[model samples]
Target: MEAFPRAILIDLDDTLVDDSSNVDACWDDACAAVAPRLRGVGVDRLRAAIDRRASWYWSDPKRHRTGRLDLRAVRRHILELAFAELGIDDSGLARDLAEMYRQLREERAQMFPGVIDTLDRLRAQGVRLGMMTNGAADAQRAKIERFGLAAYFDHIIIEGEFGAGKPDRRVFEALLSAFDVAPGDAWAIGDHLEFDVLAPMRLGLHGIWVDVRNAGLDGRPGRPHRVVSAFTEIVETPV
Candidate 1:
């Protein structure tokens, strides 16, 4: 563990970027944006309803897989359910609200602190890098371009492009192969314990969990090779 990894496979959302952290805030903003158009519906009430429906929608593994790929449709469906719960019957309004949320999220997207510098240092050290993300191609590509991430990576695998995503061994294997680096010489880093850590560990790759929320393992199933609260820590000596 003293030596740096030969290669690295990292995740996009919530790991290097700040997208999921602002989800609720963006939802609130979207709800407020459409408040004037809602009849007899308070912004707070609508937001709460949408939040509840969204929770239910993502709780299922199947829905989560499908929903992440088509977030707009998922949001529209969640809004429709929220509308039904509130006795509002406007499909057009629901669609517009979903699109509003999507735009708000995109406009506010940002990378985690020091991510650019960390990636730069890794590249300077001759560490092979790959980005493994699960989302629609356009959405993932937009973030990569916006943050100038492509220049730092040797391989970029989006679920929409690969036709599969993380926690699926194939995606992880493909990335390691792309770098021509053995699993033991590489690390999988991300916020999601399952997709970023356990999945790659299963393939003999070191797993580094970026606990950006400062949330400890708290009896989480698998053990990560290392855990740090930020991306910058990966370059430093292991704690």
Candidate 2:
């Protein structure tokens, strides 16, 4: 029943937005954009290979931290792998596909249910809001503008712009500094346990896992301080 935190930092992908649709659209667009350059190579095979490699590298923390699996890097590496296997050599085509996919991703972002309304209510309650995402500025900013979700936040921090990704305390620290709030005075909410919950919790912030699917990531030992099913639950719950 105590209102301990005055500000909230929210994650963009899969937390406030339905990013799965955006990702799917990007994949489709990437395949089509690269298909002509594939030159008789099986598009399905190439896409499957890229998906496998992307998932493998993305889920591995060691590979991610070692600079082997960041977003742009992963896209380029996957294209290289696919082209190498198909005996193709066209870096220009790969670059074009990457850029196309990036644009498509921003265009396809769909805000999650209750996102705008909940944010509006939170702002009305005088809660300081901030955004923390891990992607290039153009894509993230585009999504915010497309969805008209930018004005609710006091600060927006993207890892790509900051030269570091989350689960790192420095990213969260920057957000806290921008909000002029102490760690304990703010709450970090995101869908990802490692990046969104654990990272901020390590910095003594009140991390809240937004488990929309009810997967119970918070039930694990040493996770976020709290977990909720949706953003609306934050205001309703006893703080």
Candidate 3:
């Protein structure tokens, strides 16, 4: 995408939304909540189990399409699995702890600094806008609605609803088709190098990495067309 691109697809979560503090807090709370019930189980051990389960869950893209893609469900599964492994049988406690984390996560989402202005400016320029998120439909929709994002995005695609996640060309194609824009006339901005940038790049859409915290891009063959530290930087130049 170049010279006033026609469309921009954005990733939710850590990209456009700031949820970092909540992530840590959620884990801390979950560990604490589950520890007392499980007796000898340490918070560190439960956290490690969550991290391990999260890695496994996200790596397999197919798992995202299933209705089981509810993030709370994933955490609940992690808690349940960990409890079972430790020979503790209290499904109620595990479910409650996981639900607690999910609520904290939903309550903490906010736009990254300058993200709203950037999006507004892009929309004012007549650039078609859309959201592509890898989450359950209801979970992702809550964040979108909580932030009043419905007016900004012309289309929204949640992997759980759409049956495909990022790094998949189909997601890009669907957005392109919806906007009636050619690939060269559109761009994608995301915090994720591989999923947000590389995936769109593969389909001929300009991919810009929005690494607000200066996170280094990982080694990947599908290079981003542009790299930016903040949304303000992207809008300053208008793509």
Candidate 4:
């Protein structure tokens, strides 16, 4: 165990907030809103069909690199599947649905349990906080605002805004620069192994993998510098 780093970088989705729930709700809303246009398409059935296509797009080896899926593209692919299922011949509808989902998603931002308390403790301990996420600026910003999380972060970097996504050192570099700290002086906490852990590890920073589900990595050779299942565990463990 070592002393906590001077600064902390956190991922948004599934790290601080339970975005999966928001995403599910957005899908449901989209299905209901589009139902009339879909005519005989049942909402539940449509949701299930869209989820299946989105899951495939996320898990497909050809689509994801190092198992890191781009959420924006996943949204588009899901909409495309929905349109195809309903025999809708318009490509523009896919874009429209994606945009609609983004709007709904921005409106629903729920913080995970213990996020605020942990963040408050960390800030009081004199640690700088920053956010690194892979999503569009508008949706991400809206979530931060709705959840009242924007004031705590010294820096907030969205990958889509920078024209790049995670698993890339450039994104991490941007955060480091914003914090005016070197990689060695900071730690990155994220739930995803590929994007959050391995990506920051490449830049010589400490990578703390938040494996809340306790799902073991499959044949992964090396482990993260630190692993925690809960947000409070961060303060107990050496950063």
Query: What is the C-alpha local distance difference test score of each model?
Result: 0.90, 0.78, 0.79, 0.78
Which tens-of-lDDT digit does each residue in 1-239 have in candidate 3? 23578898988877878866477777787678667776777788777777777677667857655534666667777778767766668888888888878777776667878778878888888989989988678878878888888889999998889998887889999999999999998989888788898878888888899776686666556568788876557776544
- In model 3, residue pairs whose N, Cα or C atoms come closer than 3 Å (at least 3 residues apart or on different chains), thus clashing, are none
Task: State the lDDT of candidate 1 residue by residue for 101-219, as single tens digits.
Answer: 88888888888889899999898888999999999999899899999999999999999999999999999999988888889999999999999899999999999999989999998
After best superposition, candidate 1 residue 229: deviation in angstroms?
A: 0.8
Reference-based lDDT, residue 150, model 4: 89
Q: Put down candidate 4 lDDT per residue, 1-239, tens digits, no spaces.
A: 34678888899888898776567888888768866766676778778878888787777755665223355676776778766876766677677778788778766656788889989988988899989887667767767888899888998887657777787788888888887888999999998887888889889899889886778766876679888875567878454
Could you tell me the lDDT of residue 131 within candidate 3? 94
How far is 167's C-alpha from truth in model 2 (Å)?
2.3
Could you give the C-alpha RMSD of every candidate to the true structure, in order shown? 1.2, 3.5, 2.7, 3.9
Better of 1 and 4 by lDDT: 1
Candidate 1 backbone collisions, by pair: none
Residue 142 of model 3, lDDT score: 79
**Global lDDT of model 4:** 0.78
Q: Please rank every candidate by lDDT, starting with the best.
A: 1, 3, 4, 2
Task: Indicate which candidate wins on TM-score.
Answer: 1
